[model samples]
Target chain A: MKVKVRVVPDGRHLEVEAGVKALDLLKLAGMNSESGVVLVNGRPVTEDYRIREGDEVTVVRVLSGG
Target chain B: MAKCSICGGPAVAYIRYQRRYLCDRHFVEYVESKIRRAISRYKMIRQGYRVLVPVSGGKDSATVLTALSKLSREFGFEVVALHIDLGIGDYSVKSKEASIKAANKLGVPLIVVSVKEITGYTIPELARKARRPVCSVCGLVKRYIINLVAVELGADAVALGHNADDLAVYSMKSFITQDLSNISKLGPKTESIKGLAVGRIRPLYEVYEKESYLYALLTETPFLHEECPNVDFSSMENRLKVHINSLEEEKPGVKITMLRNMAKRIRDYPKPQLPISRCRHCGLLSSGDECSFCRLTKRITGQPLGPRAREVVRSLVASLQLAPRQDSAYKS
Candidate 1:
């Protein structure tokens, strides 16, 4: 029950447990749902979206500027 | 996968505020509609007008340029893009390239101005020489350059890319700091004063930052995704943005509602009409005998570089080869 998670701009990669909500996945990667969006297989999904086994998850940071 | 609210198609996004899911095509339409509504609500553009869009190679600015370019023909206006190369190392280089790509894709004429060439100092250099923070120096330089270029080009309005989240956070910060006058300037549009400042319009006024990013990505608009190297993540504004977005997570559409309410009551907090005059050095708007740009340059360079900067921008504008107006592009 492991999924691949990749964060954009920072280019970080992590392996997290499947069935975790997208929001929780972001938290595990040291990001907040408020500042970024979660995409499953290149399509944006809500924070409540649950990851599946072997799913490719990407987190794109939206909050920018100083 | 979620289904599009309007059609039984695979959805790309779920707009919590609207309680609807939208496929890729529908999402683009929704964003464009919001842009059109903001323009109509503010009466931002008019027929036979030229708009100067200053692009910074960021998602917000890219989204603004793309939307405006599509609507320009329909709205009976021309769009010209301006990209100021602040010379922040590779960041500036990438920014200029993205600006060029976006402008080329839209077939909009673009003017490029190099701060280093005009002032003999990059933004960071100027900040060090002037003993001011980099962000402060950059802001002053951009404001002066934008206004100068817009005035010289005879642009009727300058389209900015400040999205809903940015404006809301700015308004809240201004309120907390008791900067009521600044809050007065935070609406969808600001009118131009003859011989002084050109009108400013925010086409992305109703669009959120996240939505802007998504639109830019889905539309394949070229933009630099990297944050400026000078960003201070610990700053109050960044903290405020996080807090504001957290509130939005709980209550969808709060940002838009708050901004709309603020716009409704904006005139109640009118900024005092300060006595404005032309800067003797550059012949642009100034509050005192000299504009802040001129004063800052004079302090750092031993002479006011405002006049030189204006001349540089003028020549850049003059050299632009604008495309022929294509009225047919707007035909429905």
Candidate 2:
């Protein structure tokens, strides 16, 4: 979807075409659903959500803090 | 005017007892001397660096700030105050307020970060899903957040509010788990990733809990006296403190002294290493592909990505499995 993927780590980014769901696209780009956090333009997106062109995304390793 | 306790030098007044007129300045000098001795003995802080003191606005942290501030002035180093609010309602409020008060009182800059604002989940909600050992998660978060913030804000070291009793229980926990490597990381001084962000240091490593509390009381530093709600008194340290409190009627000072010594001994004879595997996904250090914490959180939030926290919400999944249990005799 021509998205800028920032893993808090830039090396984890991958550019792909639209039509792929955001979750699947992230998974394909080595984002582990178990420990990964997905934030599209600073807001979190659920798994079922899809990706569109030009989305600025940040994916983090889910740190469950008390 | 009071006579000196030890060297019998010029003294202002008797400090707590006879032959102990250490004087106000002398008392500070004495504490500072002990702190300096420990720093030199342990090689705690390096030259030309900023130390980040994690002040929770609690008595421990406020007293730590006051002492360290004095150290900074005398020892000619710098210090920064850091506060993290786990979003625990009024308790967290008290902590934050207390921290601000300390910062104002000490005239040090304080940084406050909230879990809800930074992460999207309050500590309690996250705790419900993340569950026990979330304390460690909180600790890790504190580390990561502080390091990240410190690096961004240009700090070099990080000090925590951990007391002697906390240290004792921590050492005991390590012994129980037989995790020598984790024990190794529990040193008075440990450097963080150089390229990653800031180096971390703990000035209060030698300071006792009771001493900290006493300092807070004597200094009148505004600090929260209550414990975090997440910490049940079931902790070994708490239990031990309670038992000791009943028997000896002494303040928390003894616990602090014993634990500090234990950690010092352990640090002196360092020989422990635990394997660290990075989380392939985030590149952060972890013991598994998905850390247990991450797995449980995902599972609780319907992700079921982890093993056990992934147990399905069967009540909704299979209506028949849930409908009949409320009243055994009135099963549908």
Candidate 3:
């Protein structure tokens, strides 16, 4: 099972394993899970949210500033 | 999908600290309520007071301005937005546009001050001429300009957008670096010195960085989602923020508790009493004969730009046509 993941502002895209937690998906996409909020099909979800097959995930980076 | 704790509607966010899921509306209300609590706890604004909010077109500042604008009517205070164009090429262009858009949406009068227009040098140019880091230069200029504008407009306080995560990371960094003075100034509000500095208040002091972003998104507030190009991702501050958030993931509410405890400790800590004096050049708050802004400009341009900067700010304020000592009046 594969899901599409897109990182905001940078517009980076990746394909990752489904059924994994949102936090793990962020890790798989080379981002710190703590640094972003995961959205599944435009709705905000918790880090424990499990991605489904073909789900559209958007990771909005929240950690800002130097 | 998780149900909202209050309405059992489709939840937009799960607040780990409180162990509650919330819909978009409730999440926004929750964020705004936290801001109100912060303001009331600190007595940050008084009735009939005017607040000057400096916006950077970023999520935190945008959220701060939006929340305060909505709160102004309830609090009996007036809110004004200020944007300083740092002239950092395209990034600055986008930032200024977003700031203008946010202010326009709120019908808040915005004062636009350009660094290149006033100082005859962009931040990068000044950094190069002064042989200093860009971020350091940017911080000094922003601090100087914000205070100057606040005083010129006769605002009762300047509201900043520093959130809980920022305070937590800074607190940890300060402790690790043994910068006790910085820690001492990390509370929700800093008092004003008569005829010198304006009081600074943080309305988002208790809100998390992610919550701020989400509030702006849900409220349809305009903000630049991109980080400044000058931001160093590998900087110690950024790393510390990431590390702190990771701790938060393991133990919910640690950031808020840490910040609260730090504020308590700060209240008990003996504050360093530094002799405050007016800058001879600009007549603003200064630790010595010359302020850091004046010193930096003098070093870079062979002349202090503080007086000129003040003149620019004064003219801009005068152009606003605000009634003398009147509250809630501004020119678009």
Candidate 4:
């Protein structure tokens, strides 16, 4: 069971095992869930959300400003 | 598996408004082109203009910085950066560090200004002396410094990184307050007044908040993610954002639609242009005799007015012009 994960802006692509948590994917890409939003299939989900095979994942930074 | 609507590659995002699936490459293309279109549509940047981008050590600003850096190379516009240090303990430390890293990464020159150094008051210090809430004062200070820096740096315009969600939230708050004046000012580009002010632009005006975060990460742009240690969750804007987020969860593109309505309203009823005047004291643009920055600084620092300051205060009082009255929640 493999999933395709593409981390944006940096444009890195990864193939990971199924059951990989969104948080773990972000961490593996040198990002943290605390600062980034993880999306599974275009919908926002918690970091603990698990990936299924062929799932397309994107980890984006959360928005804030002065 | 849903395929990209553009390229038919594996899709990474489903744009609710367009009902389109986008793969990694196509999605990146879509976002960048959208930004380019926004800049042209709004006439935000012209060839060889010097634009000052303020970095908040967050994804929003970093995305703007990175995007503009990429664009400037080919377009011949100069992009410089300024990072304001609010001096909020570790928050400032982390924010300044991230801002520096991002600017350095982009090879953009950055100037760091501290509230304490510039105004003799840090944000917390100003908050303590402020009659209004901290966030309001914070907003005032940021805008002031942005204007002040733009003047000092000789920038033709200031570029902000506010994304769609931020704009939508601002629109919602203005709507709730029935602040038509504020609503009129909302847009992608604010044309620079001939005598009084540098223009303002939002390069990411059409971008979503989530997409901005992803852009920074994808570009390996460094940014701080920690919530402001001094954030007052009790503020009207914060509460509204929470409610809006819930609405967004239930209905995708709710924020975008709100923004669209805001734009439509602005188009339907353009604001009467106000004459911009220079502040006698600071020589910056002012609506009245004193700029909002000068008035705010005087109030927070408790600086007694000289003949000049007194004249400004008198003008403000006579005109009944005050910083837009904060809602009851902002009463200190």
Q: After superposition, how far is residue B111 of candidate 4 from its true place, in Å?
A: 1.1
The list of candidate 3 runs beyond 4 A from truth reads A9-11, A18-20, A30-33, A41-43, A48-55, B326-332
Q: Candidate 4 residues B110-185, lDDT tens each?
A: 8777777666678888778766777777887788667666654556789998888788778778778877577677
For every prediction, compared with the true complex, DockQ reads 0.60, 0.01, 0.60, 0.14
Clashing pairs in 2: A1-A16, A1-A17, B5-B19
Output DockQ, candidate 2. 0.01
Candidate 4 docking quality: incorrect, acceptable, medium or high: incorrect
TM-score of chain B of each: 0.96, 0.71, 0.96, 0.82
CA lDDT, candidate 2, residue B299 = 57
- Supply the DockQ value of model 3: 0.60
Note the residue pairs that clash in candidate 4: A8-B218, A9-B218, A9-B219, A10-B218, A10-B219, A60-B214, A61-B213
The deviation in Å at residue B173 for candidate 3 is 0.9
Give residue B272's error in model 2 in angstroms: 6.0
Candidate 3 residue lDDT tens string, B123-193: 99999988889999999999999999988898889999898888888878888998777888889988888
TM-score of chain A of 3: 0.81
Q: Write the per-residue lDDT of candidate 3 for residues A6-39, one digit (tens) a residue.
A: 8986788888788888778777656654578888
- The C-alpha stretches of model 4 lying farther than 4 A from their native spots are A1-36, A39-49, A52-66, B1-12, B20-23, B245-251, B270-275, B299-332
Residue-level lDDT tens digits of model 2 in A1-66: 266666643345666666566557656755433334455655444444566776776665421111
The per-prediction CA RMSD against the true structure, in angstroms, equals 3.9, 25.5, 3.0, 10.1
Cα lDDT, model 1, residue B180: 92
Give the clashing residue pairs of candidate 1, or none: none
